[model samples]
Target: MTATIPAQTGGDLPAHNITISEFGAMKALAILSQSGKENAGVRVFIKSGGCSGYQYGMAIDDRELDGDTIVHDRGVKLLVDRMSLPLLRGSEVDFVENMMGGGFTVHNPNATSSCGCGHSFRTDGAQSPDGEGSGGCGSH
Candidate 1:
């Protein structure tokens, strides 16, 4: 199934749903088709460990586990597990290209801070003991 979400600007995201940009969706679709996983979905999740208290993860998955929230935007499917939902609510999945390289990224409204690599983040309610998360982004 597919869903059409209205356009939202910075800080104006839907309170309970995750959204994907046009560019992001296009790129994701291309990747999935190229990988022969056109029927699969991208799974987005948050896990303990990163430069921050929590790290972001994504994968091309064909199975939907129990308690998974499936979102379809612009022909691309995004799967988020129940345990990671609260922290990822209202986030945006985007793809960026730069001189360095290109990759998928999460624009999370719940994050208070993120690592330099943008793969890790800390939310208001998940602060570390020193008020900061340790370890380099390269380690993970």
Candidate 2:
């Protein structure tokens, strides 16, 4: 189920549904290169169960799961599984650095509301279409 996202920048990858900012790509590349893993990439996924019904997760993984959407930016691979693609469509992956601190940030167009922590969000009243609400981060 692997998909090659066309490169939006300088790479030869297929276009990706999600775009990674130059700063984000550089940051991710640095982390992956220093991770001591031979061929590691960044994995970004969404899980159902954040304060806003959905939470974003990221990590460095050496393996590519089936059905993963692989996008390359600034020599870094951004791996996103199929199920999480729709939730992240049209999103910009960015890395922000400031006096307060610095970290990865996802500016998702699909998120209707997000938690103060910026790691959880609700999708335009669709997170729970079955009339039942998903619990938040504290519930876990």
Candidate 3:
């Protein structure tokens, strides 16, 4: 989650995933543009749902509480809520523009299992496979 990314330039656009360009950052910018809010953002997190165990939820909001962790990437800034951060610690969110399944995808190394629907993932207790889920996995 604390990966160090070199600064971005107007010439070199930042990147989150190979398939989808600026997954979270682009989504954040898009949300800001629509809300017409100067400092708004898109928040991505996992919730207890779907056929598996957890599902990805995204929303556009213009509010920031005290315990939010912000990830600034590719000229776009995103705010991840405190509660949600635990489950999504080291996940790399990607945007996949595919005919079969095209949308923002979370490359969660923590998840032990992910449903075939590309949503809902489950991880072991405190330890994920890759140890990225230092915050522990969310429960249903």
Better structure of 1 and 2 per TM-score? 1
Model 1 spans with C-alpha error above 4 angstroms: 1-14, 129-133
List ranges where model 3 is wrong by over 4 Å. Answer: 1-28, 125-140
The residue-by-residue lDDT of candidate 1 on 6-87, one tens digit each, is 4344565567577778899998888788777647978889888788778889888888787787777777878888888898
Task: Report the C-alpha lDDT of model 2 over 29-112, residue by residue, as the tens digit.
Answer: 889889999889888898777667777888999998999998776687888999899898877788988796999989998899
Question: What is the clash count of model 3?
Answer: 2
Ten contiguous residues minimizing lDDT sum, candidate 3: 12-21
Task: Give lDDT per model, in order.
Answer: 0.80, 0.79, 0.59
In terms of lDDT, model 3 sits at 0.59
- Evaluated with TM-score, which candidate comes out highest? 1
- lDDT (Cα, 0-100) at 72 in candidate 3: 60
Candidate order, TM-score descending: 1, 2, 3
